[model samples]
Target: MSFSSIAAAARPRYGLSCALAALCLSYSLHANANTPPKIGGAPVTSVTAAHYYSFQPWASDTDGDKLTFSVSNKPLWASFDSSTGRLSGTPIPPANVGTFTNIVISVSDGTYRASLSAFSVTVRSLVNSPPLISGTPATTAAVSQPYSFQPAATDPNGLRIVFGISNKPAWLSFDSTTGRLYGTPGATNAGAYPNILISAYDGYFKATLPSFAISVTVTQASNGT
Candidate 1:
């Protein structure tokens, strides 16, 4: 055979081998790529002394790889679970009353790691108290008449209080900051609105007024028959 013919025969085999090598290299690189684990949670920033506090960060790994948990600047009064990333404990008054700062929780999937943003927990010396809500809501409302009721609340710790209502009537509007429930009922809205609950939250604790109801009745004619 001529030298040129020998070289041409070998060319096809060399090209085939190179293509197979490239395919194997691509697969190897993808199979070995690592995915990092993710961790996140919103822990309460303020806790009262002698009160129980707890938080657990959620984590996940798409590769189903086993994950390990870790923490930095954990509070001395709290206990941690390495496998689950839970931080919880009670702060003893006078001893643990202070602020713990720059606490970070992290997770690792052996090859890669992820972490939550640094956060802080403040332990207050005063005991926590639930906000107070006191008032009687009128049970009966007349259609086409303006109706209104405002609940009063006080928080001993003077924390900003926010109001909330559940099972509210469709005809009424509520003020979250003032705890005022007011609106006019229409003829179509005449019915018994039951199990209405008004609540106050003082940042940490909640106090709820006893459940009440309102019955809408037809408006009485102004001129007596």
Candidate 2:
């Protein structure tokens, strides 16, 4: 073959090979652009009540595309900052004190999206303060007479208070829910009762008041002359 004819034959094949390589590169780039972003982060297990809490999640796209972050099923006391991929807020007491599960943190690269559900957050209850018993109970009672009194108490956490009594006399009845002590003493029950104890509870903690004594006197019956 002549030199011109050989060069002409090789030119077509070289051009075809270049075209095939360009097509393959174009397809690779397109595929990478469609790849989803990978989401990654750890969950906070515990946070103090009424305190600020914050956590940042991470995401990346293989194609270097811009990513956006979001969250779902977040607690009402907290919020997710989509622009910064941060979860932050202050949690209230009691109502916010519990384990929260399956908070979905998601990331998207416009065309594709990814999610991480491994994060669970816990808002711990505030330290409980002992309930306080207020005032002293009356130390005297009359036989066959009705008596009723409620021991005053307070809880620093605003929790409901329960009342209890120890070494109670048979004539006296105690109410745990309302903290009331009430009952009628029989005529034969006239006597001195000592070391009667009263206590208060605020669900998680308790406090007791000092001991006191009660004297029940007999009622004199009227006789017609």
Candidate 3:
């Protein structure tokens, strides 16, 4: 292009104040990720409490609002607190080991802006055999009472537990897909099942956990729902 044209185009951005401001913005955004932000801290996580743990983040933005936490890959049993930026919960039960868990914790102004952070969780159960149970939930049914079963257990490997109520009443069913022990009861009152067996896994090695056995407990309801 022409020399005069180039000078004219650079005029606006070349001003002393504008150049300095742009330089500052570039430096701020490129700061080290490990450098703590305002709520300055680390995305700390742990996995010692019954295949469960918490994740919290440090804040670093200009706003004064609180931080928040959450999970993405492993389904957690507890909820996140936005006000304190803490994530306390049980990672999916029966603790399968060695699985790669990814969770996202986002901090925001509660308006239109938010920043996301990620965490990884690993599980390890102490036993080899799934948990075992001595008694099962009742097979009896009421008009609206469907029975549910959640097995009790003991892992030979001593792994942490995530369980299931395997042997359910006619009205009830075990969610082989999600481990949700649920079902409906239409008429039965009692059954031959005195105990229910569930396979539980522990957080072991890279698995974060392995399997074990657990007993089931039954409750009553109506629809096989």
Residues 142-209 of candidate 2 have per-residue lDDT tens digits of 87778776778888867778898999998888999877888888877788989988889866678887
Query: Which parts of model 2 are misplaced by more than 4 Å?
Result: 1-101, 104-120, 221-225
| lDDT scores in order | 0.89, 0.82, 0.49
Please provide, for model 3 over 36-103, each residue's C-alpha lDDT reduced to its tens digit, 9 standing for 90 to 100.
22433455454533544666666655544443433355444556776666766654436434444566
TM-score of each: 0.55, 0.48, 0.33
Cα-lDDT of candidate 1: 0.89
Ordered from best to worst lDDT, the candidate numbers read: 1, 2, 3
RMSD of every candidate to native, in Å, equals: 11.0, 11.9, 14.7
Write one digit per residue (lDDT tens) for candidate 1, span 1-225.
Answer: 999999999999999999999999999999988888888888888898767889998999989999999899999999999999998998877889999999998999998989999999999996667888899989998887888999899988666799999999989999999999999888889889999999999767899999999999885642122
> How well does candidate 1 match the true structure in TM-score terms?
0.55
Per-residue error at 42 for model 3, in Å? Answer: 3.4
Measured by lDDT, the strongest candidate is 1
RMSD of 1: 11.0
Q: Distance from true position, residue 63, model 3, in Å?
A: 4.2
